[model samples]
Target: MQRAWVIQFAGLAAILLLLAFALPRYAQMVPEKIADHVQHHLHEKGMTWAGVRPAPGHSRSVLLNGSAPDAEAQQAAVNDLRSLWYIQQVQDTTTPKIIEPYTLHIQWDGDKLALDGYVSSAEDKAEIAEQIRSEFGNNADLEKLQAGLGAPEYWETLIHTVLLKEIKPLPSASVRMVGHTINFAGKVATTQKAEALSKALRPIEEKDYHLAVNIIPLDIIEPYTLHIQWDGDKLALDGYVSNADTKAKLVEQIKSAFGDNAHLEKLQTGSGTPKHWETLISTVLLEAIKPLQSASVRMVDQTLSFAGKTDTTRQAKALEKALQPFAAKGYATSVNVIALDNAAVVCQREFNRLLTQETIVFSTGGAGIHQESNALLQELADAAIFCAGTTILISGHTDDVGNEEDNFKLSEQRAKAVKGWLFRQGGVPLERMKTSGKGASEPLADNDTEAGRAKNRRIEFVVEGI
Candidate 1:
């Protein structure tokens, strides 16, 4: 019994000796083994493993941070890690934080523009208000009451650029936020302005942000005014018109009514005009005025008034009769007529007016006149003979589309051509006509559009010693 007990003690000692040698090595290998397994699993699932490390002084806990190309791969990596029996707890800090949506709202009343709702910060609200003020002028009142919060930094520049540079001026506008998008509604001054605003906002739409914009034009009851001064040989028109089209129409009427016998100095602005006021001038009153030494006419708010000295009672009667239609349509007219005077000054004045009224149309990019201009050329020749002693000034103009030097040369050639035509065809002496060229200078209309360019390309005539 004593020998059997001694043998059991010896076996227990041998087991203890084996454990003492193996336990230290096992502890050393545990972390390495866990790190290898995790890295291998993430690699198999196309994930990026930053590293795996045991918490210092803690045998079981581990902190992991890694990334994957997609959510599925991330989930697979997490699953593979949790499957290990040795791992106790795993915490992940690699998920992207979800960002909530942001919004801003703005409203305009009378001359005041009010900003409200959420912006990235107070600085952002002030920035937006300043942009509005820059475009809307000093009279516009700007109010800001916005909540300060975080938003994308790029939004500041984007909103300011669109509002200040692209959008048209408005009397009233309102802006509101809807989800991750914006909604703007406003009253624009004109349809053209609204279209311009739409075109400017097109780039913002391409960025995946949704936009809801509504623009309506204000209805202005009182259209712009038209004022004209017609003397026997000289007519000067100055004031506002509806648009380029209206200006062109009025110019045509002036030319037709006086022929090339009157001097015309037209300076008019292009705004939107009243409905049919131009029709009254072209069709009725201007057509009826026979001959006058001096005339002043003001057409405004459906009212017509004229004060002038005519050569005959017949001329006075004609003007009064023609204005009767306007009177019937709630138009009020005051007419003043004086005695007849057919002096040499009137003849010279008529010749000067003719020169201003007529435009010698030419072929494109050449000095040759259009065939349709023959009648106008003949009238010009007759006027030159009527005012034989006066010098006829033939001036040429071109649109701003070419080199300045080239344009100048072209204008000179065009003026010389007209002078030669008048001398040969109209029996006007060469000494009686002087030619000059004004290349793209003194434009009667804007040179931006095709219609305006056409008006710019013209031949003007002026008479001296009238």
Candidate 2:
């Protein structure tokens, strides 16, 4: 028995050496060998072979050959090819996959499926993820997810063809969330984009878009920097389109001046608004005369100072009148809109207009005069500037935009709100002024669009006998 076993081992060793040599020589022949082998077998029953391509991440590729005239022949060829040891896998395939544009490349790391591809934005990412789920139904393994479709190369091409969509990315708009607030800090070409961003983010209940819209007194016409940030319940903002405090004051003051019953305070802090900030300060040149156009805003020791080339006396007086309501509303006020003289400059522009004309003003729905208004008023007072003690008329007017009565009421409320802020709050004597509402009866322009309507819905100075 021992001798027979030894002879059998020697025979096996010789056979193994011969087979190893034959396999090395045959490795090169597998492609054509396999293709020919497949075709010949299929031919015995009448058939042909079609296509082959590289399998991702491997030197060996898959070749799908043999076109069968009948379903049975097709299935049989596929089964025969798949049964071969040299063939990793096999399936029927069609042609013309050459014309696709987008390509998906994926890496299969054992732990997590690393899905990496160029996606334009939030929407694009969501869409592709959804499409993948729809096609493969969420899966944890490569076999179930991408590989389930076919060879890796085939799957990559298919996804690129069907999944990707070409879209010009919306320029990056910087936003930061501080606490419960969102603040914007960048420049977008259009105002609609800024507004849309704010509106769209309404889904998060504990947050709001607070903008620090920068505007120069005359250098530019449009807002320079539009900053946005998000917080737990609000928005924090910081940017540099220039005129930082000016933008903050303008938004808050305008909202307060117009009287937004729906007052909300959500803005907080950021940076990177530089270009827009400088552009904002330039806008000051757009509306006012040459002298006032150069006016600048500065913050020192928590106070805002206005510096410009306007008249020392007139601008100061205007500032006093403008800030009166905010002071009355119990805000710590200050201002200085004077010519480049030794004295501080504080120009009272809007409030005085309201007092004299009794025009109604409408707010943009979130905030009112805020602290800056009061500080502005205090500045005027400290500058010893005061408007004539005329029985100033505070009138609120709306354009022919919405309900006339509502506009009328809004106008009245706005005027009265200022009066309360000025006299009852800022300490202006009640007897010095009164409020009224004129609903869209006056038009400075055609009330067909926003600019026209805005002109029409102004709070102006209509002199009542002092």
Candidate 3:
């Protein structure tokens, strides 16, 4: 009986020892099994990019790693592992998939609606395409939609509520979404429609997303007319432009040229403006009117007429020739720039007649003028004032009464005396008058007789810059 008892004790002790040895191995295997099961679960759920492993030093916990397509997928994986009987805890260490510069572009051009760029998922792509097809008819082109990650929150809401809603009433439009930014451009039939669309887009703008809206109105007016007149002191602008943007650009150009003296009179905006109309108006204002003293440019329909006054025939002819190219390209140009030389010629004749009536008497053999000639000098100045901007030459002549050198000196001094008087009393600029001394070089009758010498010793005035 004692031998049997010893054998039973030894067997029991050996069994206990065997259990102690195998239990540690089984415990280790349990973690491995849990890891395998977790990984299989992830695979069944289509989380191919994810992996799971038993937590170090912890038997019932797992660490999930790798990239998830979105936050929802990562959370779902964690929840799924936690629901398992063997998993006490789940440590999710997964990152969201990255897509840089996530973008979506939509365009509707009267006949066709085209959709392109990235969407968050295949479901999102299908839904967006369906929405576009329903709203814009079957003309939607959705072949370019590609599934990607990194879309902003409520991205589809922006497209459906803001972009599509605002652009639906337009004739032609395009909307682009890149990251948190949205840009919309379109053309509407009236100003009221454009304003309403702009107002509708305000909600998106207020949400701190970068938003840009460009809505153009297509109101048309018949027989577009623009008249610009510069009457020496003030410039008047009366016109009809294609749109507000065109009107702004035109006004800016006018302000740049005419400064604050420009008066805008009933300048309105509408469609039906000729092609390149702004370009033609700018050319006339900037280039053609530069040399004109008083200018008028008129545009009615396709015809552009320019009438101005310049100082010379050369300027008139040059301006007319420059504007001729517009005529060759379907634009009718009527350029009538009158030269002021005819008025200058009439002034010259009047001055010459005044000088012939009574010569300007100076101190004998000196440069000083006599007080008796003041009335005639005043008359000459009044005549010169009428032909403003004309260049006048004040020439001094002397007879053979003195040495040639002395006569030259006297003639120059006399011419200078007359020029100084004109500048001081007549308000004539010194730059406008040129003085010369002919010193008996040019003879009126032959400088031999007393009367001929007196005529030769007189002063002469010539008008130039015609």
lDDT of 1 by residue, 1-466 (tens): 9999999999999999999999987886776677677766666655664446654444554556654333444455567677778777665644522224655566665466555545555466677667676765665444545533345555566567774454435777777754447677887777678777777776566655677889776643355556677656667766666567876777777777677664445556554455566677677767655465666677776667675655666776776676687777677776644334332354456545655676678877888888788888876775565444567788888999989888888898999988887888878899888999998987889999998987888777776653
| Cα lDDT of model 3 by residue, 1-466, tens digit | 9999999999999999999999999999998899998899889989888898888888998999988866667777888888889888888888888777888888988778887887787778788877877788887788887777788887877777777766776799988888889889998998778878888888887767888888877776667898877767788878787778877887898787778788886889877778878777777455677557887788898888776777787877888887875786688877656567665776688678889999999998888999999888887876676566789999999999879999988998999999999889877888889999989888787777898898888888888854
Better of 2 and 3 by lDDT: 3
Give the alpha carbon lDDT tens digit for every residue of 1-466 in model 2: 9999999999999999999999866765555555566556656654443444433333344556433333444455667767767766564663322212322333322222334322323344455567555544564233322111112232332233421210011232333332333333333345445555445434433223233322111233332233322211222233333334655664564344334432224332222232323323233211222324233344222223343334456764665564344344333334444443323212235345323443233346311444545654443222222333445566777778778778788777766766666664556677766788887887778988888886776554333542
Cα error, candidate 2, residue 188 (Å): 21
Worst 10 residues of 2 by lDDT: 162-171
Whose TM-score is greatest here?
3
- The per-model lDDT (C-alpha) reads 0.66, 0.44, 0.82
Please count the clashing residue pairs in each candidate, in the order shown.
11, 95, 0
True-vs-predicted CA distance for residue 298, candidate 3, Å = 7.6
Q: What's the lDDT of the predicted structure labeled candidate 2? A: 0.44
Cα miss at 337, model 2 (Å)? 7.3
Over 4 Å off in model 1, which ranges? Answer: 1-106, 109-191, 194-223, 261-263, 311-315, 339-466
Could you list the CA RMSD of all candidates, in the order they appear? 18.1, 21.8, 18.7
Q: What TM-score does candidate 1 get on C-alpha atoms?
A: 0.31
